[model samples]
Target: MSVTDRPVPSHDRIARAAFPRRRVLQAGLAAAAGAAVLQTTAPAEAAMRREGWIRSRIARMSVEQQVGQLFVMRVYGNDATASDNRNMNEYGVASPAEIVAKYHLGGVIYFAWADNLPTPAAGARLSNGLQRAALAAPGKVAVPLTISTDQETGIVARMPDPATVFPGAMALGAGRDPELTHDTYEITGAELRAVGVNNDYAPLGDVNVNPANPVIGVRSFSADPALVAELLVAGVNGLQSQQVSATAKHFPGHGDTDVDSHTGFPVIHHTREEWETIDAPPFRAAVEAGIDAIMTAHINVPALDPSGDPATLSKPIITDILRGELGFTGVVVTDSLGMAGVREKYGDAEVAIRAVEAGVDQLLNTPAADVQYNAVLDAVRSGRISRRRLDESLVRILGMKYDRGLHRDPFVDESAVDEIVGNATHKARAQEIADQTITLLRDDADLVPLPAGEVLVTGYGDTTTVNLAASLSDHGHPAQAFVTGSSPSQTLINSAVTRSAAAAVTVVLTYGADTNTAQQQLVQALRDAGRKVVVVAVRNPYDIAGLGDTPTYLATYSWLSVSTEALAKVLAGEIPAAGRLPVSIPSQADPDTELFGFGAGMDN
Candidate 1:
């Protein structure tokens, strides 16, 4: 689907289109009605105009309280340790529940640690804990609390024990499968909503314009801007279908840089015309499709704002372009206040104040609550920014809270969260995607089937690959799987070379893009041992730049254990290799070159 496939229609038209797609029967205010509501509802009294006592009971607040509705800072649970405290201090708060209660804060984004006892039933329990805390203190009126989470596939996921993972967005785009994209994201959203996650900052619409981009490499849908726009729209629509709010993020683009925007500032140099042409397409498509939110990029776009600050602080980009030109009247959010792109340069208090000045509806991952809150209060008192602007942002945030039905009721079914999270269906669907997206980019020697002799398998030490090895016992071969990572005094490549001599074909597998040293060691080991190394380029192909003399090679651009097992079957000749490279896997020394284009592969 091209950008022109659907002209940027009005929000009413988009809502009409989206209503049929949604299972909910909720009627929303039209633009005119919303504008009228904004005009008639006073800053201190919008909560009282026409709402019922139950909704008005807790949903309305003063202008100051309304502005407070726009900041969704990161939070930690009660069991946080020293490291957790340090991490939170960098950008989040120590006790989020208390902050929400006192400040009447809008929402909390959970960046829960890897081993924080994730369970399907935990989502609601955690949400209820936060909600109860947030509602402890009544506002001048009353307002509900909002909770959100980042459950992107394979990265920062929070699926409970029984849950499975689908291929990330890039794999779906690489496979050129829209049905798969729609189905996978829909399942993901269902799983999230079942457990009480209302907002999902996903379907990374940013095109992977830069292959070396540290953050967005495999998270993006495709390198082609057009395809990213198309598949991303489908992905967002799929998520929205499940009643979960889908958000397009890293606005103005994040896929064209090698540096990590989280730790450093990277600049995009697209011209104004190019912005209209390239970077803005995905976001514009989402808004036209009635997407709930758009998250600002931390990276600087020189053309959008020459001030060198990220788009999060630039009015020309956020207000003038995003709000004015693009006609996105929905919530506009910042990525995270603590990200180095903005934080290393701006003050905590100033970050919150400037973001609002830029017309943002939500301040993500706030730095210091005390500093940020005081700065906003100072800005309001000093007349630097208006009560109207604050109220304007707050109204949208309140609308979202109302839409979430928090205003009508400020509680989650804490007891119900466990039943819905990480259940059988969720895991099965994740496994299905894991199996489906597992591709076969290379199989040059057709030396699969293992010949029933010595077999060698290896990949990341993480949970996925370890599970693959455990599952591979069914293949009827003597298999040895090694862990891949940067090790002390020893490397994965060195270990692979040493072990390759004893195996028939070193069926090497790797997950995640950063595990390169292990892959290199495997290639070198294969060459030195004179073994048939049927290499599998999992995840980002950018990792395996040099594979020495390995005649047999495969690309299964994923690390899911199910996919890894499927690849093992392909190697064992149980199934024909039907997958191909969604992205090019370049050779060694030619780190700048691509061996094959997207969709390049061999099959039966």
Candidate 2:
């Protein structure tokens, strides 16, 4: 039976009743009698070969429905009554299926927590629910949506329960091997897809040009352009291997800026040549390697696009440099419009209108989705944004969806997910990568694998060196651990100096960051004690500048559990340290190491 002749399903009636805004708009999208609007045409970029049912359905959508596919709206996770109750209570956009149909939402980007799904059986159940929501569309296939999430490891933990947490970008950066980076992303992508996630906005390609930068911190892989590029390639290949598209982010460059774009405009002060040589290399490499998506940052690059608008809506940057100069043909997407960098400057509709005019293909986390839609429609009506441009972007977006076979029967295989979700092979890969990436900066006198010594451990932040100290103690060595939330307190320093005076060794883990006021003080503290100081950088490799030559130095580059275990193994001489410095270490006097040469290494 034809779709119209078939009785209206309960879901259609409910969605139509709940979202009159959508029903009235899409009532005319069908080819049947009583249709109020233009019938759907073949999806702008609908898969050229797939004859799947969903593909056929997408091919039938009208222009408006095709345009709808460019949007990716955020949704809170549900399926568990407790989760549903909590997230739904916080955000009103509950009942994802109805919301999908009502809003004409192309896809649902769920902010999820899966820590509760401990067993394979439990994970499959939840993955199925999310997949159902992703495939939900009232009476249409041209309206097929793309589900996405920020699964960038430690930077943003999705599920603290049910899922294993891998050390994030910083940890991978410390390992300094593209292959390890590859395995890291592969594992992350596999787990995400197994849980029904289709897009991972990850593998942050920023060069991290500033050490004091609060947010990016160790999140960046390295300061070296070449290393970052190779890592980006590995990350892309790994994610795509699992069919989870990874997005390389912060287009022009977000590394040099010290300001957090989420709260303010981050100014990238490098010249055109500087950007091309360093900050832009990784992104360029990712694009060349056929990365599926590119997300623009909200930061301002004065030299590249001085129009004062964020790259998200800047034509010169997105169209002129990104599309024109760089030769990137992939989808050009915008970061969240809700971020302060964009919202503080442009109104929601205006932001949406400009992004399209600037050649953006997808809109992520737009606050007023309908407002942006209406504004784009108005621009089309006013001849402000050319219909050709709109169609062009829509075609690119649709083409990707079609390639993914989203046009026909887009649901993920629920039963098959259990086998792939947190698979043993993936975890083993992570462990192997971790084993190879840990760096031993200064292993003087082969002092490591110490026969026996009373060791005193201290560092920045709240995370104590209790674990490291315990790891040392198991070898029949006496050890003590002390921790503070802030950078080393005066009392902690005094206590550490006194304790070190009588100890065989002192191992300090700095939890705060690379550039700090403690560099000079740390050196003085160790000199006063005349102790063998072993400083392990748990944040950024460049942070080791604080240690000087006072004692031994090691940079784990991240505080993730894997890297920690790796460091423990290195101290125990379980594996030879093979990780080279992915980025340069700043000179002892220069605490900010913005430019570090890649492949800097030393043996244990």
Candidate 3:
């Protein structure tokens, strides 16, 4: 029979079947037998009731269905169209509906491709269709799926337009206001929930200590563990308050490594003491703050586990360290298993089995869900992994789903998506965060609050640069733009220099100039040409050291439109540079020498 043709089970029926009165009575009687001796604890009785329900549900599930509950597969949101369906089927990728119906997946994660719907209404319709499929799957105990996305506000946002874009974590940290951080995440959660995403992989707790760290640069809150912890907890509260699960990610810290775990395993040699001091504090705080989930990092910490296994597949790390030492009772989810860090070492099947045995409750983004599911089922049948162990994770997963109220109403209101997403208030709050987070690192020439005169804006012609020019012009500064590539050709630089000669002040925008020599050279050439240059590191603050004697420097931390507007306001003296550096800036001559400390920002 087709999955769609199957009869759907009512929520009450599933609930009653999951927690049978007979079993509940049996457990209650046993508890009551000891009630006089133990003084009848309501909490204990409630726990027993929950355990009975989970056990009854597992007892009713087929092996395949039970194993499927452990996997959260990635699905395309664009699969509602015939063309997308054809392409997905040709590529052997199942539609979101098909995956939920066939595999009975525990959850679905929306990627950028899936989330590129025409509007919030379209996204809501797609999400509702997927949930309906899960509900219609042929099963006695059909549970609703947990829908999720990487809606981390700035660069990592998966949901397309109509979702307000806030500054990244580093910029939030620069703002140095926990209340603002909470409100930002609360809005992020509300928008995601409006579009039917229940889980958010965000508030990255990594304390980015290594300036050269490629992947986690601006995604992290700060280099200081204490500050990151304070802000991370606020972020957690905000998301949970909005009825979305917040995941404190890259467990035990992925911030110090130079290698990208997406491609390879980065080894951190920090001892237990070192880790406790630097890498573990944010996670510890997250556990205490009641973070819903903790995503494991693919990097290997030798001190934590001598087996050289990454935390995603290490029992000692996930179970002993996070669960035991930190006392985190929430779900433990794996980073994507498709990443080379895990895939290259262990095949999909082995990785799934190992992750389960290592105490990971959810297997995320596996290369092939069917293969992993079958492999886990085979392990269970062969006694390689006990069904009891499987049940442990299943209980937690189901408990979270129930707690999220998915069973009662998994679908979102399609009309509400448009109403809640990117509303006026959210956009204003985003602009406010951007305005407050502009850090003035260097202003030796007192070039800011420029006297009424013509201004030259030159950059790679990115969105941020275009917005900056428009914002300046709007603020009555006659601004002319000199556009260039991210790595501008000499001709472009020369042209910009010639254009700058006519303006009272030259504003050169840079992205990753600390690493990109071309960006550094362009700034140097403008300086050498004797243009009064004010450099803004739009992406990374590390560019300050690379600009080579620029008279003025500022850190916008991101290139979002709001950030660009804020930059214009700060430059025009309409808004004070109130933000501080979240991470220290290293000297160009000596990497060890601190050129600017973490709280260093000046306001005129």
Go through the candidates in order and give the C-alpha RMSD of each one to the true structure. Answer: 6.7, 13.8, 10.4
List runs of model 1 lying over 4 Å from the truth.
1-60, 78-96, 114-117, 408-410, 462-465, 487-495, 511-518, 548-550, 573-580, 584-593
Better of 2 and 3 by TM-score: 3
Q: What is the lDDT of residue 264 in candidate 3?
A: 83
Instruction: List, residue by residue over 1-604, the lDDT tens digit for candidate 3.
Output: 0011112223343233223564333457667687555545777786787667667777888877788888888766554332355326533554667666666688878786654365767777877887887777665377778788787776687767868988889998888877788889999998888888889998898999998888998899888887788788878888988888899999979999989989888998888899999999889878877788999999999999988788899999999999999999888888898897777678888999999999999999878766888888899899898988888888888877766767578889987787899999999988988888988877788888776788988886566667788899998888877788699988888888888888988888888888788888888888888878889887778887777767789898888888888888988889888888888989878988998887888885
Q: lDDT of candidate 3 vs native?
A: 0.81
TM-score of 3: 0.90
Worst 10 residues of 1 by lDDT: 1-10
Q: Which candidate is the best by TM-score?
A: 3
* Candidate 1 local distance difference test against the native: 0.66
Error of 2 at 508 (Å): 1.1
Instruction: List, residue by residue over 1-604, the lDDT tens digit for candidate 1.
Output: 0011122234344345444552433356586577566566674374553234434533456545665677786655533222346435544545555556555677878665723335665556666666666666653455656567666665446665655566677667645656677777788787776656678888787877666678887788767666667667777888877767788887878877877978998888778787767677777777777777888888888888898888888899989988888888878888878789888667788888888899898988776776787678779878887877876776666666665556556554656555555557766665555554545544456565556577666545556546555565676666777666433125556666677668776666644323455456555556666777666666675554555445556655566655677666666666755544445555545656776565565553
Query: How well does candidate 1 score on lDDT at residue 548?
Result: 49
Instruction: For each candidate, give its TM-score against the true structure.
Output: 0.83, 0.81, 0.90
Model 2 RMSD vs true structure: 13.8
Scored against the true structure, residue 533 in model 2 reaches a CA lDDT of: 70
